[model samples]
Target: MAGPGGRMMMGQSGERSMDFKGSGRRLLRQLLPEKAALWVMVAAGVGSVALSVAGPWILGKATDLVFAGVVGREMPDGLSREEAVEGLRERGDGGLADMLSAVDFTPGRGIDFTTVGGVLLVALAVFAAAGLLMLVSTRASTRVINRTMYRMREEVQAKLARLPLSYFDQARRGEVLSRATNDIDNISQTMQQSMGQLINSLLTIVGVLAMMFWISPLLALVALVTVPLSVAVAARVGKLSQPQFVRQWQSTGRLNAHIEEMYSGHTLVKVFGRQGQAAQEFAEQNEALYEAGFRAQFGSGVMQPLMYFVSNLNYVLVAVVGGLRVASGTLTIGEVQAFIQYSRQFSMPLTQVASMANLVQSGVASAERIFDLLDAEEQAPDPVRGARPGQARGAVALERVSFRYDPLKPLIEDLSLAVEPGQKVAIVGPTGAGKTTLVNLLMRFYEVTGGRITLDGVDAAAMSRDDLRAGIGMVLQDTWLFGGTIAENIAYGASREVTREEIEAAARAAHADRFVRTLPDGYDTVVDDEGAAVSAGEKQLITIARAFLSDPAILVLDEATSSVDTRTEVLIQKAMARLAHGRTSFVIAHRLSTIRDADVILVMENGALVEQGTHEELLPAGGAYARLYAAQFAQAVAEVD
Candidate 1:
């Protein structure tokens, strides 16, 4: 049966043994959060089992009393004909009285209707009481386990928030999702079904064994032999099945990951005509899952029948020996009957324990995986309290900045630059030249390895992350809009409630108001997930409007106008010119013409600044910036021709 802590007793060796204790301890600790309710449930379960166990023994006693009454003999336990008749009369049971009066009071001849009827009624009442207690216990357990799981789910969500972006970069989205959903669900089911089954089984075994020994120690001793044999069988099978359960869950995660990738990239797969290839990969994963699952289930499946076989042998032995004892005049038939029933009862829990072994093993494996996630190293803790500056003039400087995704290979080194307030600085470079890394450092998305970046002469790290980000606004090329009304999308970057007028003004500032008003709902038009209903250019405009609504003192525009047509680009350029008039703006672009009027054009190559000057000055210098401008200009001419 399910053991304490809701684990099956796998009398095994190696990791299985340790898993039994370790996983059991952790699961118990999780339950302790709802311990008060759990304890009450346990009490009810105990009472229910106690009442149920009393049934067989009471029936056995009543059997002996009735036999003696029919024989017109007094019971050895002090029950007599006079007492039975008197008790029947006291209860005013006329039907029983009439039946008893018809019987001749001859030894071992007729039934004692009153005593037998009364005893059967008592047994029914006892059984009904037990059933009620069981119902209450199960209901309480449901509430307790569900609430505990709810708290665990909340903690997992909060834990995900505290983890670093780097963690997500290294982890698979589907695998993480599987842990949160499937793995946790396994634990929930195990607690609900296996826990109560285990508790009831254990109580039944204990009560039945006690009764067995009280009646005849010889019969109990024979039944005890099967216990060790059953244990050995369980241990051997459990050890074999444990690793398969691990493999089963691991394969399940891989299958989920593959499905997620296929679903997310279904269009790409179809365009490439890779449906056959995709099916092949899925079949491989599915086969692996099937193999592991079959092994795990088949291994544990053997234990129940094996234990039952041993139990059947024990039952036959008890019956044969007990009959012999009755024939020798040392045991009553009623006592032998009770002992045989107890022998059967003793084996049932063992059978239950064997049957639940697979569930318990799978649960432990899932729990271990979940705990691994919970114990993963989180991001370095942010300061509990830090500087929250009121205002910023937007002067930014980087000194001796160096960074690398990996320590062995550096991506950026000694990247130093400075920008005064209200200056438009454009950073231009080819792909993989670290143009975006600078913005990442400025935003503290990734920490610099070597040097400090400053905002208005103060080390940016000295300020809280919230305070640092509050003073700057960013508009990225990959626009993101949630499922909401257009007005909500525009007001997303705002810190407080935004009125309709303000949202419209922000849209106008981004040159998006005209198109927005043309929609059926105007600013209230609903945007689907990923803004799929809108064109790429319109999505970019929505993001620009969101940035406009924030109105930070500093702005970072990374290819903000790349998706729009020439007309929309020109409008956006004019709008951005107004937005950046007095703010320190950092512009990153590939089209050199977009930043021709920037106060300073910084050209980067291979993670270091190679050229920095006004647009006119850099063109005359014939340096890296001049070459980039000429290449782009020639490409544009070639395209037009």
Candidate 2:
């Protein structure tokens, strides 16, 4: 079953199996580019097939010539050892001695003066042509496969960038990484091998069958007796092994996810003393992967031996019938020889097909997974009408807005609020009181389920998502830093040309300049993942600097100082005041001291605002705001003492 956000659910029964034929064709179409070079490669494959069949026939004809001279009374038109010997005997009479002296000769096998040179010439040409065609086909197919893989990788990466954040929240990072890297590599390998071998094998089988029938229909019929049985066995094995292969890949992804989690949280695990439990859990996942892999591989491995046994049985029957016909003198020994060669050729391709069955099956499984992701619906389209810079007034209004992450439980219920230009409004609440949800709606990360939000009389849904986001600046509680210089991080969202002096000024306003200047490279120093090089307070300041650089008409501060010490909080509050100047600001905070100066304080509980007033007004009213203020103030005082 697929869960919300298109995540697959695992169970004892496993997910529904995919149709290999349909999935394979669809994947191949997507991967192959629409270009003339691709068509040329296919044409080369066809030519190679034709040349391969010709090579085998030429070899078979040479074998027939030898068999004719040895067993049949009639000599082959081409020269034989006996005929060459006779020619040498005639040449020894001294009339042709001069001609013989001009050529180098080997003593073991005398050559016929008339026909040996021509036969050797034809044979050499046949082998050379076949080898040349094979080489061309191999090269062309490899180029096509590599180009196809390059396109697939590019598309997958592009899709990942465009996918909504909610998709990442539900899907495992390790699994997505596995699909893009390991699974796509497998698909490319399969395409290369299958393209080369499948075409060659099919041509070999067809060519061998045609020759066998031409030589003797009875022998051809005898050799084909194993075809149906081989196909039936292979089909059964493929069906049984397909599900195991899928399960093996699924388990591999889970194992990768577990290992990534454990490695990333090593410090937390040590603090909690969970080393032994983590090791045991890892061992269990390893065992599960091993079991699934073994079952899938074991089933595929038995196919070759089973196919060989059936082929040998058919070979014996062909030999007996061919020998009986030769004894009755109705068939020449050369024809019997040709028939035997053709029979082996027919069986050989079936053997190859059997061996490659598992490769094909695994490729199909990978294709199915890849296609599932490609077919997922993308985020809803943004409005086509472009946004122009409006008047600097930052009035924001929400009219009966309602939202729910899950339909069964509403996070914000019919809430409406308005903030005039240059107003500093604070939303105070406990955990899960719809504070962050309100910010998310205002940023349009998630759409409102019902009602409308307008900015300066423009409906948010009617504006381009990019334009909407660009006009608002947010400082989140969790600050994310990319691997870049401090100057780059501070100016991340600045669209206009911003000078180094301007970046430094923003950092100073956010109270981050003193610490940044002391670093080894100052503004040029690179930050590690999530700014691990800096303390949490420093990271918060850098985020505030980024917001300041954007110079947005509206500012949102969501628990911006929640994780910092008291002194750092005081510094950030000063920076916040500077940033909030002349902008419509919305602050969501749990600490009472942070929001005490808000021009309007809205108290929310259970998804709705239960009270609205200034700090002084709310305290005397003794409503939800007063109760929250009292509780948080007591905690702050105890910490201070």
Which ranges of candidate 2 are over 4 A from the true structure? 1-13, 66-117, 322-341, 386-389, 496-502, 565-567
157 in model 1: Cα distance from truth in Å? Answer: 1.1
> Each candidate: RMSD to true structure?
7.8, 6.6
**lDDT (C-alpha, whole model) for all candidates:** 0.81, 0.78
Please give the TM-score that candidate 2 achieves against the real structure. Answer: 0.86
| Tens-digit lDDT string for candidate 1 (1-641) | 22223332211112333356687689768888787788878898889988887788778767766655644653223544455555566789654544343333434335667777898899899999999999988988988889988988998898988775656766667788888999899989988878888888998998888888888888889879778888899999999998998888877877887898898789889999999999999999899889999999999899888988988989989999987776554666667777888888888888998889989988888887777678766666667776654568999999999998777788989988899999999999888889998898898877888989989887887877778888899888778899999999999989889899999999988889999989988988998876866787788788888888888989998876766788877877777677777999999987898888899888888888899999989999999988898999899899999
What global local distance difference test value does model 1 have?
0.81
Candidate maximizing lDDT: 1
Residue ranges of candidate 1 with Cα displaced over 4 Å = 1-21, 70-110, 522-524, 560-564, 571-581
**TM-score, one value per model:** 0.86, 0.86
By summed lDDT, the worst window of 10 consecutive residues in model 2 runs over: 95-104
